[model samples]
Target: MTDLDAIPDDPSALRAALLAMRAELAAERALRRGLEDRNERLQHFIRQLQRMQFGRRSEALDPDQLNLALEDLEQAVAEADAEAEKADPPRREARARERRQNRGTLPGHLPRIEVVIEPPTTICPCCSGAMHIIGEDRSERLDVIPMRWQVIVTRRPKYGCRACGSAVVQAPAPPRLIEGGLPTERLVAHVLVAKYADHAPLYRQAQMLARQGIALDRSTLASWVGTAAAELKPLWRLLRDDLLGSAKLFVDETPAPVLDPGRGRTKTSWFWAIARDDRPWGGADPPAVVFTYAPGRGHAHAATLLKDFRGILQTDAYAAYKAVAGAAGDEAAAGSADGGVLLAHCWAHCRRRFYEVAQKRPAPIAHEALRRIAALYEIEAEIRGRPACERRAVRQARTKPLLDAMRPWLEQCRAQLSKKSPLGEAIGYPLNQWEGLTLFLDDGRIEIDSNVIERSMRPIALNRKNALFAGHDLGAENWAVLASLIETCKWHAVNPEAWLADVLARLVSGWPNRRLAELTPWAWKAEQDALHRAAA
Candidate 1:
């Protein structure tokens, strides 16, 4: 029945009916607004996905942009839910209870401040008698304390001997990373970590310091960095020597631009990365990477960098690497074959060529190649972390047949296409490096790709994007030294800032050169873990 027909004749009854209708209408309007908001959000999310999939390369969103979009959508959803809860009070309570139940506990390492909230009285109102507590509720929330800066003042009092008044004695001054500088070793380490690890340039850091009422120039920070790099150069050299001594290594290089004041422009330099990670095959050696800055990307540079190395070098099909291996082979021909460096090609590089072709247009051959490579990757994933002998055996049993068939199929496909075509070139990459590509089948220690070192180069790229270019060649070398140590610390899951502070303090306090090995990231991590265990 209609509202009018169902209404009572009395004025009071009619007024009550009108109020109920108004409340119902308000709730309906709130529900409609919530639905509309949700619909708009869903539409935006769909459009983003479609654009990501079908958009032009130049129009596509980068990782950070995509993350930002998702964050906004999440916030919008939260707002809508909050409005809905405001409209329905009972639903608000239910949702709050559910959220409390699902909430994770805070970390135990953080200090807690207790706040006891007691009732006005402990007596029972009905009985007028004292009541004892039976239980209590407790909850925790994360909190943060803003960073504060303070100056450390040092003073030394000199005393004169009573008999020999001319002779005064006092304790000698402590050495620092920057002698007679305002900052301590810990503060200098923070600047280095912020610049290299966090990719905060010195100028930005100086600006941040200025906000905190400290007036420091970017050049002052740069000087601190240069002095730290000089002090830590010995450690970097030790790390490089240690990595090169590994029986298997992954190597890659990326362009690093340096400002050339004479030409009034930046010149392209290179940062060559050498990485050793044996954890994949369950080897005990800790993972580490070292970057060396070179003025040029030439065969001579690669040869000189690896002159003292004598092991397997896993890398992409870069021409300079081939020349280095060839020279090593020629030198070893007169002696032992084991002395030569062997090269293992990266299959990811080969797959990338095909992927690029498929991305541009439909190519059944390229898709088939990708599918086959993906299957090989799946098998590799299953055998990862297994012993070397077991991994080699599994590859021989399962991976060898696939590789055997893939090579012949690739040859047939290449024959069907023009040599200048994209598909033809993609197929030719693997066929050309068949020997090195199959090197992993015999030695499980060698990976299917040099992606390890490639992954290590990304931080350098991020730093380049932020700073644009280094001031000069020496600046680039310093960048390499600091970046190598910081990246190695990350691999070992150690705090780069803490480790750097301690190491810098030790170095300045006359840490013996012979004990430099103990200052390495892996060594420091081991020592820290040992201490924690002992404490436990």
Candidate 2:
């Protein structure tokens, strides 16, 4: 009943003070709620990282998950473009760019095996007179002569020795890849190049051969392939050793399914493609790719394949690669303690993760990340063929600053996003492998991504897609061997068919192992060109 109690009961003046106190309390509550929400997001981020890094990948987003919505959007865009095109015709330049009908001049080196298609009647009907020799309009169409089956009769003339009447003189027949087989080395090479390089299934090739009245069974062709693979393995080993000796290399692997007879189903194998291409940064080594088939995708496989290699190995952020790098300390794999292989991770893979998430959920953070990474690619496109020193300077000047800004920016995004979200999961990849991801910044000789090796795997993919799977483990090994040589020929811009044909002939003709480099696609090309010039 004092003045204080009376003041508490008062309405107007106390109300203003109470209102101010209530406003302050509401703000504190709002801030606390915000802190709690942020903490929840952070916890999700941590859980996502832990799950990805340690927990089963099945728990995380499936790396191979497809976004159907993206396909739908693309189809919709195409339809819209088609409608627009119908309304307004395409520009001349665009039409010209699209037109691929222009036939170019064939190579001058090809022999002119002419078959003059004369007219049915050379006489003029009006005059009933035979037309004299006149200028003829010549049009060229590429003609392929069906494979001619020939019997190479090697007649070794026998004679009685003059000094000794009982002795007989005879010449020995040449050694062949297939001792009693009817196929010539060139024929075997043709079959191999068709199956491996051209992605033709053996059955299809057998059918084609049967049309020529050869009637060779599919098993016969398969046996030839197997024997050829065995014969060519020494060359494959040499190529692999040479590739490993390169200072910088790109590495990748694609699934190669092998038929498991015991299980009555196909088992997954791997064709590990190790590639060396120093041309990007202007290194002298010619680009090459060698494929090794393994029964499993175990870390030991990578270890064995790269055991002798002691340089930069650019690859994707596959966990097995991490183990491979770790095992550099082991004497068995390392060759020597000082000969440890350096790891360089692919940025394309990092961009790919963010790209997938961006497609599903459009956000400013992901869009920004994509835009910044695109800028790095733009810089790479510009300086691709430049010398290493110049490339290094440009990267340091242009790419380095963007990368420097990107690190903190990514961290800030991580702080804002929940790690469990797709964007957060995408962001965690580059963050975890940041050191490997940024290895290119230090060495210009190293590429940003293992795309060279990836490009080399496409033929294998095509071959597998057509052939389904190899019949057995040895079949997969043969696939690897032939694919490696044929793909390497393709890498050097050599006609794979021509190279295989020539190499096979030389191999059967006793090409020395010490002079194996002469039969290599690049060297053989130079030698062929030189011979052509000398003939000219």
Candidate 3:
């Protein structure tokens, strides 16, 4: 080989060298662009995901509730084929089974009923005589209670003063739950309680009430709700103050339909809830739950609810909440639109959306996230009904630090992922929604998510689905009243029907104003405790 041959290169060789360099650089640039896009997307997705999942609903429920949601979602997914999006034959069979047992208020335990006679013998317990069977035994199950109509009669008597030769009627009775109205206070209470606390609607209630021969026209029933609600306006305000005044408050909003009178359009109203238990902050009161009706579900609604409220405000990612709070500092506006509110985010909700997507695709990244979330839930489950302060300690010790470690891992997953993809939905959703999701860490009283509000919303949802819309402002307000009271009762573990019937039955004219409060669930509960103590 000549030295000239090694040194000299043909034009072809030089051209090939140039081409290789260009191709190598091009590949490197392309790889760099892919990494950058992945990082950007992951960042955005995480921020958005962090906003809120189911908000207050998931956090407020007991572990069993989460289990129930998991069960429902599992059954829902199993029966459903994403591509076909239809139930398989087996799924259809399961659907029938579910429907048969679809009563509401999902009983915590199956009741054991004792009968005097054995089932095989259709004999009467009183006579022990063989009796012809009227029909087959029938059973209907529901997610909660199935209401039936109950009539309560109140009679105020007239007494004549014969000795004085004067005729005087016993004072006209104090206003009933429905003063001179169609439905009894108990009936109105039942409707409000069912619709708001249980999420059953008035139309369904009309049907339910009809079963018991309480021929309530939906309009007439609506009128009674309006009237009864109007009477309780003062009470609602008092309750609202009680809730907002608490140091720890959880807030959430769900859409409610209000009838548009002139256009007949169903306007969306906001059903906002604020709940807090004094167990953490104040010792005396049980958990106080309050529901407020707003014209719209904007920041304004939330602002009004939390105005002048100094405490922890737990909410999800509606953007409106932060904006409204942010605007509170701008002094240029009319005397602060609303006072400052400290907001805490929810974790359970953010995790849930990811969990759903993870269900569809269990990639390594998603699986890891699932494992982390499961750990948090396990902590919450262990102390199911624990006090707020203890819960805070457990979460602070367990959840806060777990989330701190998870952040870097989440960022890494985001970098390797595509933004518009399913993985993006799972990963990015929580990341984007991070601020609110993390807000809870700072406040001991604020929940991990707004599950309590969501639980509160379910009762309203059931009622809305069945009844459809509130007829008028007064009608909606009445809904706020009864729902607020009954839900509070449910929150504190009191039966609303029992309280309302007893309160309404005792509305005597001469009774002192303070005595009337005994009808309220809190007061009624106090009275019950007193009675129980006496018996004990």
Number of clashes recorded per candidate: 0, 1, 49
Best model number under lDDT: 1
Give the worst 10-residue stretch by lDDT in candidate 2. Answer: 64-73
Compose the digit string of candidate 2's lDDT tens values, residues 1-536: 33665466567778986898799999889868866865674464345334533455443322211111111122222223333333344532343234223433333433454434444454444444544433333333222223544434333334343333443333344555554445667677787888887887767776786675556656556656766776677789889989988888888889998654334456899999899888888888878889999988988898888777877889998888777777774654647755676799989999999888889876888889999999999999999998888888888999999999999999999999899999999899899999998888878898888888877898899988877766556567777888889988987889877777678767867788999977777888889899999999
* 324 Cα displacement, candidate 3 (Å): 3.5
| Candidate number achieving the greatest TM-score relative to the actual structure | 1
Local distance difference test values of all predictions, in order: 0.78, 0.71, 0.58
Instruction: Please list the residue runs of candidate 3 whose C-alpha ends up more than 4 Å from where it truly belongs after superposition.
Output: 1-219, 261-264, 278-285, 328-340, 383-397, 433-435, 503-520
- TM per model? 0.72, 0.70, 0.61
lDDT (tens digit, per residue) of candidate 3 on 282-344? 356557678887888777777777765765667776777676556554532457544465567
Q: Which stretches of candidate 1 lie over 4 Å from their true place?
A: 1-146, 159-169, 336-338
* Residue 474 alpha-carbon offset, candidate 3, angstroms: 3.7
Model 3 global lDDT (CA atoms, 0 to 1)? 0.58
- Candidate 3 or 1, higher TM-score: 1
